[model samples]
Target: MSNLEIRDLHVTVETEAGTKEILKGVDLTINSGETHAIMGPNGSGKSTLAYSIAGHPKYTITQGSVTLDGEDILGLTVDERARAGLFLAMQYPVEVPGVSVSNFLRTAKTAIDGQAPKLRTWARDVNTAMERVDMDPEMANRSLNEGFSGGEKKRHEIVQLELLNPKFAILDETDSGLDIDALRIVSDGVNRYSAQGDRGVLLITHYTRILRYIKPDHVHVFVAGRVAEQGGAELAERLEAEGYDRYVKAARAGV
Candidate 1:
């Protein structure tokens, strides 16, 4: 079984003012078939952790180790990390002006798999993935994320997730900007992907609504860049009712 482990991860970024530490220290392990939800207030370093794991150059890992199946991932480049079965669905997917969605997906798949998928099967697979996310067939011809709605961008991310079939998926606020129907469709797509029984998912979000559809095996409450509390699904329900006020207060008071 595959495992993704983060040990005492500390990260920082260079802002206009100066360098600022984001992640203080974080330790978590996700085994295959497990879904872990990280719920936190804004600026709690949730997205920083996701970007760090995905090898974003802007976030400097001052200390800690991230490993996938016992292999050190910190040393790998972004593309290399992708090849190692790590995927990140950004909150704001950027637009690639000239790259058609179809070409981008196929190229990414080829790079990760070290081979070009057979043309016919690949085309069929692409169409199937798009349909699963409720995307129009015509979207395949559009430049990636260019002139797309926020919901469309999020849906496209899921399409990539389904096609790439990564071992671990880090979805940073994937539920953002999705309407009720779109949320259900996107959640369904995520559920289908997670049902494979051999993949791990790190779902980071601010609200508990998505949890109603995509049940997490463990729910971690992130406070001040660290996990202050963790429990089963019941914890999420409590957070939904009580909110993060208690945790935020405790963190501010140096708890």
Candidate 2:
């Protein structure tokens, strides 16, 4: 069985208006070395699902449970979840104006690893990860994502993914706003992390372009607030050709 499981999960967010239901009910299981692609329309609860999985405080679990290896994780804090080997590379990576990339990475790595990586070797690891993402090693000394281009921000997330080595990762729309070359570099970095063989990935995207490079073991079409269809990699190609018209209609009809 795959380690990560979400069973009939429902989530709500406390917005200024009130508690807003985001994830109606989501069920999915991901195992080692498997990639699952979640394709959904905007506001279809894709990012919400990722955040709920990562134990984001803003997302309240109204029902169901998320378990890793048999232990329920709904009660875990964000940092606790991270230490349990769960990661979410957000669609929008925020910049820290004063913290250098190297400092942020060092802090994050130590937190995730539960101990500091060897000081001398940490720099080497950071440089290698940066190079894999096509980033200059010099960028490591710059403030984290400060004034970085969209592609640069996304690449920085992949760099963190590499250094943290999380067992399970939800890549929330990491392919957005990338040019062809940037897309290729980001995909390569994702592949590098998946090469670990025991790692699981939930890749959330609106378009299937990234799937062409990093094929998914399964593809799910999420419409409205729930999953509408699912299949193997070929499902992604079908959606690319036909668009989401039929699936959205199907979701409406079912609703």
lDDT per residue (tens digit) for residues 140-229 in model 1: 999999999999999999999999999999999999999998899889988999999999999999999999899999999998889999
lDDT, each prediction: 0.95, 0.90
Off by over 4 Å in 2: none
The TM-score of candidate 1 is 0.99
Off by over 4 Å in 1: none
Error of 2 at 237 (Å): 0.6
Q: In candidate 2, what are the lDDT values of residues 1-255, reduced to their tens digit?
A: 348998888888888999898877788899989999999888889999998898777888899889998888888889999999899999999989999999999999889887989989999999999998889999999999998999999999999999998989899999999999999999998998898899999999999899989989999888766778899999999988999988777877875
Clashing pairs in 2: 2-31
Best by TM-score: 1
